[model samples]
Target: MFSTYLFFFLSTVALISAVMVLLSKKPIHGVLYLTLTFFTLAGHYILLNAQFLAVVHIIVYAGAIMVLFLFTVMLLNLNIEGEFQKSTLMKFVAAIAGGMLFLVLIGTLKSFDVATVGNPELTQIGLVKNLGKTLYSEYLMPFELSSILFLSAMVGAVMLGKTTKK
Candidate 1:
């Protein structure tokens, strides 16, 4: 009963923050809303017994990524006066596209079979030790590849920054 209420509360906050992120006039406010959304998602992860995921989400997204977004917004000095308003036609098209995507997502989720999704006795799958073992044994290559991809992205960002220095 308590968990149900908690879930609803967190989900509502998450949804509201996500909408605020999009609707916020200032870039910093949008970033703050995005951070709130991430925190709520981490709360969901905690409720789902994914402690590792919740911690990582808080650390990586709410901590590091949000700081990066805040810094970027500050550096760019984006303000209402410097920004151009979107045309009504463009806004209408974007709304239509967003609605279509939301409908597609709902349809796909409705077709999904939750019963056959995972092993019935795999409750310990979210534990850090089990996750580490699985990552090292079965998903090692993909994990290493992701690290390499991040490294390349960092290098690209540095190169871009260097070019802009002049």
Candidate 2:
């Protein structure tokens, strides 16, 4: 009963913050809303007992990604409200695409069934070793690739932000 209540509360917060992120006028405010959304999402992940995912979500999205967004917003010195108006055609197309994407995602998640295993008491060896093993073994390539991607993105953003003249 409490779990269901907590789930609904957190989910509502997440959804509302997500909408605010989209509807916000200022990019900085939008980034703040997105950060809140990520925080509430991490809370939901914790409620679901996915501790690793919760921590990783916080670290990646709320901590690192949001900081990068804030830095970009500050660096860009963007003003002038960025033309808040959208054309009707663009809205219609966006609505259609969003609906299709939602349907596809629902269909994909229909196969998911949450079945909890008996709570095996996790020891010190459970977390760090397990995570390290997966990171170094199964996902090593993708992990290395992600590091390279992040490095390249940092370099690219620096290059783009630099002013040049002929």
Name the best candidate (by TM-score).
Answer: 1
What lDDT, from 0 to 1, does candidate 2 have?
A: 0.83
lDDT of 2 by residue, 50-162 (tens): 66777889999999999989998888875347566698899789989998999999988889876867643333333546667877999999999999999999999889979
Please provide, for model 1 over 21-97, each residue's C-alpha lDDT reduced to its tens digit, 9 standing for 90 to 100: 87888878888999999999998887877777889999999889999888888888874542776998998999999
lDDT of 1: 0.86
lDDT of each: 0.86, 0.83
Off by over 4 Å in 2: 104-126
